[model samples]
Target: MSKPTLTDLNAFKAVAEQRSFRRAADLMGVSRSSLSHTVRTLERRLGTRLLHRTTRSVSLTESGERLLQRLGPLLGELDTLLEEASSHEGKLTGRLRINGSEAAIRLLLQRVVPQFLALHDAVELDLVAEGRLVDIVEQGFDAGVRLREAVPKDMIAIPIGGDLRFLAVASPGYLKGKPILETPGQLALHRCIRQRLPSGKLYRWEFQKHDQEVLADVPGAMTLDSSQLMVEAAADGLGIAYVPESYAHAYLREGKLVTVLEDWCPHIPGLHLYYPNNRHVPPSLRAFIDLLRE
Candidate 1:
């Protein structure tokens, strides 16, 4: 083609982001020489130097500054539109990427995912499930699912799941003869299964009674990063696990585990799907959201 291709804009964006051809090359999965040649080709077509280059640094020229300022967003939006169209098949077929916690995924997938896909049979979903909170914009995710407590104020949050309750539970084997903790203060004396958060801090046990809320830094015999692990540990009668009620459902039904201190645990706002306020709401995302409601 005589005209520039999308690859050209992508190369420009990569170079601009890194300010180094070598770094851009690594990011774009291309050789340094190839990146250099591509930039040279782009400059030739544009008939101006877009970058001021030195041995150790690269910055935009006057012309480059103007172009970069305007080009960056325009190109990004173009890519978004095209990708959305392709992913959604112009709202006829589509694919969606949802970044979220594993627990959140497990909680909603059974009811929401299947119905949403069935309604939009052409829509495909790729779930990025991790406990670590991710920046959806920086990571180029279409949308993110997170608890309302963690969502940023700048994003638009649509509540997808109802109120979630924390349940303090242990195996019948573990709770036998243990003094029941009727208050939040007493949890400190118990051997609780703890969750190590991404911030390198253990999750503070949270409790609510009537209109009052409490966050307790409890001592633990064992701490794990994953909720699944904590549940397994609790099932083995290792310690009392303060976990989401959803995770304890099966055990609660089978009498393997029993919930304790029900009155102390309060209902908290649940999961929500969030997206950048500045970003165009893609049809695919809308379709997926509707599925969550169903």
Candidate 2:
């Protein structure tokens, strides 16, 4: 019997771990049919059925499970060793996948991304802007960007931006006839725009003054999942919107939106870049982190 090549082993491993040919193909950047063919060739060489595939799912055979148990750690170590060697060469070259929030993406696009790419032409950064928090490892991301408070305790986190605050604002037209909001409690009487969180729950408007904090369940005629949309809705006289100050900056400057209950808005910890605490830091990731710090 001919020996299975590394490519064949890798294809099998990806399929076994992902348990779905389509998902494995996406991660390997290959066509689903090609990946399936490679796995079949591998199975023939081994003279055993490695996977049981049906219309909806795939499962590994007993022999396949044993092979996975033996090969998974070895492959992980090999990848790490290769990454370490690449780091010693002093040239960063590889893909760096980052899952980030929309606010974080805005910060990167402002200057960080362009500068980093210009400096390291060999590195490719794949950034996905996600509104909802996700498990970076399960999602196959090297790192993720989120507010400091949102980062998991098991992850190593580094601040990437300064403190941020939310602003409650509305278009002049919307507020013209409504009573002015004097406190967070008075927001109940106003038509507010609310944001829907990734968990499918409405975000409660948070406020603070001195040592007192209040979470207001402000009612709204409109609810949106995007901060940009909230700002736009407020600017179009739909309702009052509580959004990140940066998102509403342009509209506020243009006199499209006016602030209300400014004293109640609380400053919060800013965005942070977080990654698994127990993994070997890839050279590409390390280089990007250094660049971000600089």
Please name the candidate that would achieve the greatest lDDT relative to the true structure: 2
Clashing pairs in 1: 87-94, 87-95, 88-93, 88-94, 89-93
Task: Give me the displacement of residue 89 in model 2, in angstroms.
Answer: 3.4
Tens digits of lDDT, candidate 2, 134-251: 8887555789999999999999998887899999999999999899788898988989898999999999988999999999999887789999999998999999999999999999
- Kindly give the number of clashing pairs for every candidate: 5, 0
Query: What TM-score would candidate 1 get against the native?
Result: 0.76
Taken over the whole model, the C-alpha lDDT of each candidate is 0.81, 0.88
Clashing pairs in 2: none
- How do the residues 1-294 of candidate 1 rate in per-residue lDDT, one tens digit apiece? 256667876787678767888878975679988887888788888888888889899887888778777776786577567766676444445457788998778766876887777777766677878888987775557789899999989999989768899899899998888878788788777898889998788899888888788898877878998767787889899998988888888988999888888999888889998988987877778777776666
Where does model 1 exceed 4 Å of error?
Answer: 1-4, 11-72, 83-95, 119-124
Candidate 1: lDDT over CA atoms?
0.81
TM-score of each: 0.76, 0.88
User: Residue 111: error of model 2 in Å?
Assistant: 3.0
Could you tell me the lDDT of residue 225 within candidate 2? Answer: 93
